[model samples]
Target: MTKQQVNKVVLAYSGGLDTSAIVPWLKENYNCEVVAFVADVGQGADELAGVEEKAIASGASSCYVVDLKAQLVNDVIVPTLKTGALYEGQYLLGTAVARPVIAAAQVEIARKVGADALAHGCTGKGNDQVRFEAAFAALAPDLQVIAPWREWHLTSRPQLLAYLEERGIPCSASITKIYSRDANLWHISTEGGELEDPWNAPSSQVWCWTTEPEQAPDTAEHLSLSFHQGEWVGLNGEAIDPVSAIDTLNQIAGAHGVGRLDMVENRLVGMKSRGCYETPAGAVLYAALQGLESLVLDRSSQDYRIRLGHEFAQLLYDGRWFTPLREVMQVAAEKLAEPLTGEVVLKLYKGQITLTQKQSPNSLYSSAFATFDEDDVYHQHHAEGFIRLYSLASRIRALQQASATDPQSGGTS
Candidate 1:
């Protein structure tokens, strides 16, 4: 494997500074034809606009801009909601979960164009390299993977800029750019810059998707979310697909600054990194579904699902979505989600989404059984027998101790 045997490569292009430089570098180093593939996972129109032109300008033979937003929301996001997967209890695994879908699409594009290899602009220390390469291995093991950052000698932003400049490549980015960001339909994550220092607070410049909590409106906004068999089919009583539903929630929740998190998280590559994330719509959805789970699932069932949810979230963050363990977890979650049909009312105000109320058609809640007042349904006398049987082992242990102390009945016993 000293030298790859690929003649053509499909590179995941983002139209960003690194990827823009990667287009020409792939050709110059590998001596292969380069095709740029961009997956539109609803990062936004601004990022996608003129992306093809930029790719071509960077020396790509051709550019393929495919829309992946619908698939991302319907296939990935909707199914994930059923599992209640939240990374490390709060992170939401935003970029981690979104990577598989994007990488899968990139692989598909490579196959369609008959490329012998794949390329990505992910840095050496980032988790995305493992995610993208793992998918390539699972889907197309024969194809080679060329990771520029891991192979090239360019160490700094200045060096990368110099390489692009030497090749006469056009790039607007400068050394002043301090942050690395990834945006999609679910969330937007910001890293580098001041975030690298955990002691430093995330300045206003670090945030974009969410309004400042203090700047949020004084009034709270209430909304109704409807779900059928675990899928969020309609928002605000209006029928909509998963993609539109996410957008609608993002708009509403973003307005109130409902989702903002600044934390030091452990990366899959075994590094602790600090970052800020804004997941406005995802926050509202999680609060709603968790409440719905409490209504539909029994105590024991809910407990097990929650335990499994934690594991599922961890696996997702580690980029093991294609593994058998992940499949098993997903299957179990889907079975539990069958009874999750309900409506939840949420109150959003200043970065907080409160579950005001929730009702499920298959709700296991029964006020009669749980009432503290006198009720004919549950006989008081029945509890005496039940308690005796339940604590029989404890009762036996106490009787043995009493017998041992009765020295009068049996001397020196």
Candidate 2:
């Protein structure tokens, strides 16, 4: 579809610098009514405040800010957690997982408002563009996608800022805000600035969600977590809502410097990028859940579950959340989590969370089979027959070798 065909467009607005610029550009370039759609996926109140006013000031006909926190936690975060989905074995996939939900919400808003096209501020170089476009294709294939960054001449931030300034569009963004951050209930990620250089260590200022390991208090904090069918249910036996529970743990764990990851990850666009992430609560939760899995899952089941987790992680990282493969893998993960109801005690100190104890109703460990002391349940002498049978092939090999060396002696003697 050509630009002239679009009469109405729905933009995934974030009230950020790029998105704030996109609103006016869409109106000027397309000469169409621009509707802004924002998904409140737990980015926090500070970012959400006056967002509608900002959208309107930038030339949007109307704005729709949907509360997606509960759905995000239940439908995306919880299921991903059950699969142990961590991108590159370190990232909890906080940013990658949130994009599909945001894009899906944009499509929903488009349908409601009778929009003809969908637009987003995601850059052509990033993974998010692929993620959002993929979802748009799956959900609303008929809608025209207007990715301005890919089509526009405004290549640099300075140019984009100048464009907005010339139009008298009020924006709060400045060049001084060096780092690009994405924050949610699960984690906070920092990119750009000094983080662009892999050799440069992340300065203390780069971290907003976690304390510095050096500054963390020496005293350790112990916490208990309860799970029901792989979903976190309680903290210290007190039931709490999913978003609140994650927030509570983030505060508790962040104070102790429990989660900080620095890695140069391979991007889906075929390039490597350096990023720093702080997933305080997710780190603690993953550790606790793994401990619980150890207590309940059998050896073979555990092995297969881990393999499934790796694949699920890749699928999530690649932005295939809406595909059948993701659903199938999630179903398998849920099956593994069926008996994973339990409680785990974790000790947090200086960026480390160690499992102290774990208990589950489906536990396979038995003292009778594991004890060093004498017990009637497991006869000590039974091991002799077991070992002989286990080594029968080796014993036969040895006898065959001896006979080969003395065939004539065997016949005469």
Candidate 3:
């Protein structure tokens, strides 16, 4: 795309250091009017505060802050929960899933404001650049996508800071903050600093939304969670809103140090990066949902659900949220989730949530069939015939080996 033809550009801005620097960089390089777009996916009030002023001060013509918290939880998070999708078996894909929604919103804002180009602060080396670009390509193919990080001379944080400082852009950030952190209603992730090394343990400062295991209280807490068609509706029998329900779980689980993970995951850009994440609410919710699944789902159905969960996790992690595959997986997950209505009682201890009990109307577990005591429901001798058939191939292989080794047996036996 030619810079002379571009008049205006809409940016997916977070009011962060990179984004703040990108605003002025776009104006200087492309010579286009930059409009900043911020999506509020429950990161925090402090992050959202003074965003408009920050954008305008950073050389943006106008700033649009769209509230996406409700939509995020209801539309994206809940559907993902239905599949029990966890990226690499640990991450909740908080940042990964949020990108598509943010990008989609930016495209919408660009269309509304009559912008000719879309810009993002994602670096060329990261997974986010692929995610954002793929989303823009899928949603707004006509709009020229501008990635300053890929094109600009500004490389490191110090260089960007220097540029911003030279422009007299007042930012409330400093180099003293060691770790790069991202937080939403679901989870908080930390990268950089000590986390750069895989051997180094995560320090106390690494966690923001959750308490350290050692710092947690000794007393255990019991809470009941109720779900209907995969959506959580109540806590301890009290009906609550989605935000409040998740918030309550976070407080309850975080107090017990229930969710903390450290992993080096493969990025979409074919590089590995280490990150420490705290997902208290998400952990508790996953445990409760699995407990409900145990009660409701049959053997074959449960196996399929597990497979779908893995696929869904990969899709979400790879930022394929708006695609047909995502829609199909979500539909299947929703169908499976229909019988998942139930209540689960979980005991939250130091960094552990044990499912104490689970009850569902559609439960397949039968007390009579599971009893160890003598009952007419199951015959004790039935296992003998079943075991013989199950191990027939193994037994036949052993017999063949014995016959071949025998002195009296022929070589062709």
Candidate 4:
């Protein structure tokens, strides 16, 4: 295989087995200087710790760790939340939404370092490969993309470990690591191992971020969340920033086992894979926002939002974040969200989060009109005319059919 001519390449490094090996592999195969770029999207200190040192030791020229937590929550997560995107009707899109942000940052680093090419450790079979490459194509079409997984001969984890060992590269990954997990502030997803089989129920070993529902505390936990224009603004009446709010909710909700999901989801790569996900904060935030939307939005508007939510979910899942459709839909969502300001209380108990109370200053609910009790505000007889008009077309069709059937009234024969 003839390698493309390249001087330098920046790789999305995670200090993982695949990326650790990719650093040296790119250097060896392409003979290009590899500059590792790490996006700190709140994956945590343990994952980021020693990442730079590891990149350099893995034969990379240098590394740049960019803090993307704030951008991630504000630009990516919040915007997607506003659209109410739930991929496949359930997945919170924790991993999908982060890709464009990370990829764009990787491109920026590539250009800043004067690199001519970008590289990634994404496997060819997975959706992340398409996501990273699609963002790369959109952001920097001039720069060449080198995906090591598509090029490398190493097929499995053990093979990757052996390849590193053979090259004398230090990697902490072992064959015993069964589950492939991805974690950030929004959620954590665990795949592979027993989760690969849909028939097999996820064992206790599968869940890392939340407690087992059976073992959760006996007492239920209550929470009051405030939202302004589709964004979570306060917690328990105390003003909170988006980042702090998610972190606080994660701890509280995870303790109650309120956001754990186990199911098989369709991947954008034309495959279905089973996994377990924990979106503690996301579950609470979504519920609160939905409660507020119910209070503020009219019936027709709410139905439209539901359709838009499905479209946005597919768009985000397919990694089309940089496109114009996303911008248009986001603006529509923002407009719908304008009136979605209110407070909602939730009950978290035994892996369940339920909306207990909802209130908005702009609520369309009117007790006088809705109550069964006698009220001068609404006339009961007025509904007779409205119902007749509402079913006017059906009534006309029925009358025509009766006239056609009765020979005395109409000589159709």
Candidate 5:
């Protein structure tokens, strides 16, 4: 294979070991100018501090730190929450949901800086590589995409550290680092180390964001959430934006040990991987939304949304966010969520969120019709006719089977 001409390449920078080495490596291999692009999706100040200086020291010509927290919560997280997408029935997809926003931002920076190529630190074996490339293809197909992990000879953290050291570049990473973690406003995911083996129980060190369930507060806490058309509009009757809502909920729920999950999931790349996740805010929000949904959506409509949610989860996990099908599903979800205005009170304790009370103006639940005692609104005697009509096909089939078994009736064998 021949090397293509790349004058300037915009690399997604995280100031991590892999990306720090990548800056110099991209310059050395492609002989191109490297620009670091960082997307601030509320990963915290620790990760962002001195990132620009780090990138320049590692051989990047300049750095662009774009604050994408608002876009991430409103455009990506809220729309996803409306669909009720949970990957493999547990993972809240915190990491998967943030990839497209980052990729799109990286592309925007590349175009703004007049860069001809785009690069990412994603490895070939992981899903992020596919996610970043898919968004790049959809948004800027003309830009050259480069992935150093697939081309580079270095394979381990020690090697990456050495590569940076050899180039006189400073990196803070060490071989003793145990877990690979990704965090944002919604949730945090931990993988690698002992999580590589399915039989090994996660040690206390594997968890950093949420308290262990056994160590959680003894008393339960009640949270009142208000929603309008499926989006969380208020917290305890006070209106709030998406970012503040999640940040506030995350703190409240984390202390109660509301969201913690350990599972082995099948990756889109055809491999099973074990990961531990802490989605405190997401857990509470999902429970609150479902409770509200039960009150507002009718039986058939709710069932249809459940099926749609499964499909939406798969589409999101497979990096199809930029496709037409994703948009169609999102629109369908928004339509189903139009009447989801309601209030839900949830109890949080010991890694669980229980919906205690819920009410909606558009609710289908009727106390007058549902009461077990005698009620004027519902006629119990009418159910006999409805039962017969509903079971007509079954009744006909039973009769046919009985006749076929009875010789006296002259039925066919």
Candidate 6:
């Protein structure tokens, strides 16, 4: 790649220590004007407040805090839920799926600001670098891509602290920062520190969004969730928007510590990393929607949908969200969710979500046909013929094997 004559650069700025440091570093190293682009994907106001001031203080020419909460829920979260795309059977893909939406908007900001280069604060060892760069290549291949962690000589925290101090940058960060955390409306994940050791149990200090399971209330709580074509529409018989619905569930579910997952998952970069996640709303939604799917989808369709979901999960985990295969699989998953107009009642108790009752307008379940008691709809004798035909090949194969081993019996033909 040729050296880019970068006059201005647009950066995906989170106003965190890494990105706060990146703004001035871009100016010093590339000698370019820096534009901070912050995507407001419902991470919360505390993280967003004073961000513009911080960006300017960090030597950015201007800052753009683009609101993407509605778009993210509609475009990314809902569609992902349709496919049941859980990474490695544990993760909800909260950060993995949120990257594409953030990157696409960053590209737009780069073009709007007339910046010739794109910069991100993702480190060399993580998967976000590939996610951001891959989306950049697909969206704006002409822009120069700069990842500071891959090129910077300052590898240690003490060096970064000294560099920031030299630049007169005020950061409320310390070398003793235990966990690396990322949060959005969907979930919050914690990595590094004690999490690096798989044998070490996650302490109470590691959890922020949820109550400890043992400390949860003694009595269980029941909540009803309604879904229409995979989008959560109602909660406890009240119509609510996607954002509000998720927030409500998060509050309710978190109180009971309904969503805490500690697992070691394989990253896209071929490394296994341990993390603890709190996904209160996501856990409830997954259980309720799956219950609805069981009521709606037929036997063969259910089988195929489960297989397709696993493939889609891999695509999402690997940061292939913008590809044609993602679109193809999403369309198929949407088709399977056409009958998912139902309400599911779930009991939340001590970090467990159990599907207690479910009712759907398009349910495939029939009590009359399934009853063990006498029913006019189904005859017991008919099953004998059905079983005989179903096992005919097995019966014939067994007889042939027996005759081959016993030549005297084969003489009768």
TM-score of each: 0.95, 0.94, 0.95, 0.97, 0.98, 0.96
Model 2, 271-345: lDDT tens per residue? 998889889989998898899888889999999988998899888888888899998999999999998899999
Write candidate 3's Cα lDDT for 116-197 as tens digits.
Answer: 9999888888888888888898999999999888898987778878999999998877856699888888888999999998
Local accuracy of candidate 5 as per-residue lDDT tens digits, 1-413: 22448999999999998899999999999999999998898899999999999999999999999999998988888999999898888888989989989999999899899999999999998899998999999999999999999999999888888888788998888877889999888888999999998889999998877888899999999989999999999888889887877888998999887788998999999988888998899999998999988888888989998888889999889998999999999999999999999899999888888889999999999988798878887788989999999999999999999999888999866
Model 5 alpha-carbon miss at residue 317, Å:
0.7
Better candidate number, 3 or 4, judged by TM-score = 4
Backbone clashes in each candidate structure, one number apiece?
A: 0, 0, 0, 0, 0, 0
Query: Could you report the Cα RMSD, in angstroms, for every candidate shown?
Result: 2.1, 2.9, 1.9, 1.5, 1.3, 1.8
Estimate candidate 4's RMSD in Å: 1.5
C-alpha displacement of 385 in model 4, angstroms? 0.8
Writing each residue's lDDT as its tens digit, candidate 6 over 176-290 gives: 7888999888888999888898989998889988999899999999998888988899988999999867877889999999889998988889888898998999999988989
* Model 6 steric clash pairs: none
Error of 2 at 115 (Å): 1.0
RMSD of 5: 1.3
User: Which candidate number has the best TM-score?
Assistant: 5
Better of 1 and 6 by TM-score: 6
Which candidate number maximizes lDDT?
Answer: 5
Q: Which digits, one per residue and each the tens of the lDDT, describe model 1 over residues 1-413?
A: 33446688999999988888888878878888999999998889999989999999999999999888888877778778889888888888789878888888888988899998899998888888988888888888988899999888887789888888998888878877889889998999999898888889899999988999899999999999898998887787888777867877888899899889998888888888888999999999889999999898988989988888899888888778778898888899999999999999999998888999899879988787778766877877889999999999999998888887789757355
lDDT of 4 by residue, 1-413 (tens): 24658889999999999899898888888888999999998888999999999999999999999998889999989988888888878999888878988999999999899999999888888899888888988999999999888887988889989989999999888887889999888889999998888888898999888898889999999999888888888899999988867888999999998888887988888888887999999998888888888888999999999999999999988989889999999999999999888899999999998888999999998788789877888788888999999999999999988888889996474
The better candidate by lDDT, 1 or 5, is 5
Candidate 3 wrongly placed segments (more than 4 Å): 373-377, 395-413
